[model samples]
Target: MITPSVSDPSPRRRSEKSRSATLSAALELCAENGYGKVTIEAIAARAGVSKKTIYRWWSTKGAILLDAVTELVASGSPLPDTGDIEADLRTHIGSLVRLFTSPVIGPAYTGILAELLHDERLARAVNDELVIPRVALVYQRMRGAQEQGQLPPDADLPLAVEMMYGPLYYRHALGRSYPDEQRIETLVAHVMRALRTPAPS
Candidate 1:
């Protein structure tokens, strides 16, 4: 049989496998050692790939960590939208609480947030990759609610989005879990009430 062509699928398959392994290794190292202690060399060693392979795909360890997290969040279940704004907000809040309390992703996120104070680039990367997408989803759903008259058309969606999420994040940053469904549901209901429009005088 003739030899395989230069543009063979085998090399491409190996490249994809190496990339996935690198991401998984990065996540595992971050979870185990915390973000500050993890390094590219350790990731390469854990991934069984050369350092060059990682550099070829990522500029810094932070970037790799971000990719690892973005992959997880992107692959997670989509935010629910059953048309009842309050219930949907509660569902999304519940999902976010679970994500932040997760053994793997939670620590990784907090570790990065701690690093963010020192490294502006890492902060920007995290904001662009992690925060914006989630915020965008919330914005879209809330804007739709405004359109549906569930919220006042004049309601400030951006602020409402922040208000809905800011407390949960603050609690996570303080190392406090959401406590229970009752607490989260109560918070969601309160936010919904604040976002609702008043009747004309």
Candidate 2:
């Protein structure tokens, strides 16, 4: 009988470290030089890893940027989940606005979103990893409220999610304004009022 050797899990940790290093390097480059100027060789040199290692992990610069964005969001922000739906939604959107408007993240986010518009793979990654989870959390909270009779049973969840996020993103992207507490409070009031109003039969 042939004996099989068991592999150590420490390699997994090392791999994760290498991946993180590469992602951090990519984000720094993107922040300093924009997406067009970032190259695999620059990322490898910044990360202190070989080009082959980066190639082994990701196929394109866009993939590296996507991973970097994912890491940034995951590490820097915690999505709000306070018990009150309106307050939680407002807090969540406000946090996002802060993140989107930050000096380090603002430009990177805009660049990645532009790439996502043209690349289906990048679009799916952004939607699945970033957008869906946050939206789904809010949706779950709204559903719970409906079950408790706090919100109307016939409430439109997708529309509600859009309502919570759309205006904030629009103002952030186009208007170049950071949403302050007053703006968040006003949005919360409007949304709550809309929820309370009975839909026409």
Worst 10 residues of 2 by lDDT: 1-10
Q: Please, what are the lDDT tens digits per residue for candidate 1 over residues 85-129? A: 888888888777777677777767777777777889888988988
Which stretches of candidate 2 lie above 4 Å from their native place? 1-9, 75-81, 172-175
Residue pairs whose backbone atoms clash in candidate 1: none
Query: lDDT per residue, candidate 2, 1-201, as tens digits?
Result: 454345444667777878989988888888899877889999999999899999998888888877776666665655554666777766666777777777667767777777777899888888888878778877887888788777888878778778888886677556467768898889877877788787899
Model number with the top TM-score: 1
Candidate models: Cα lDDT each: 0.82, 0.78
lDDT (0-100) at residue 108 of candidate 2? 71
Clashes of 1: 0
TM-score of model 1 relative to the true fold? 0.88
Clashing pairs in 2: none
Please count the clashing residue pairs in each candidate, in the order shown. 0, 0
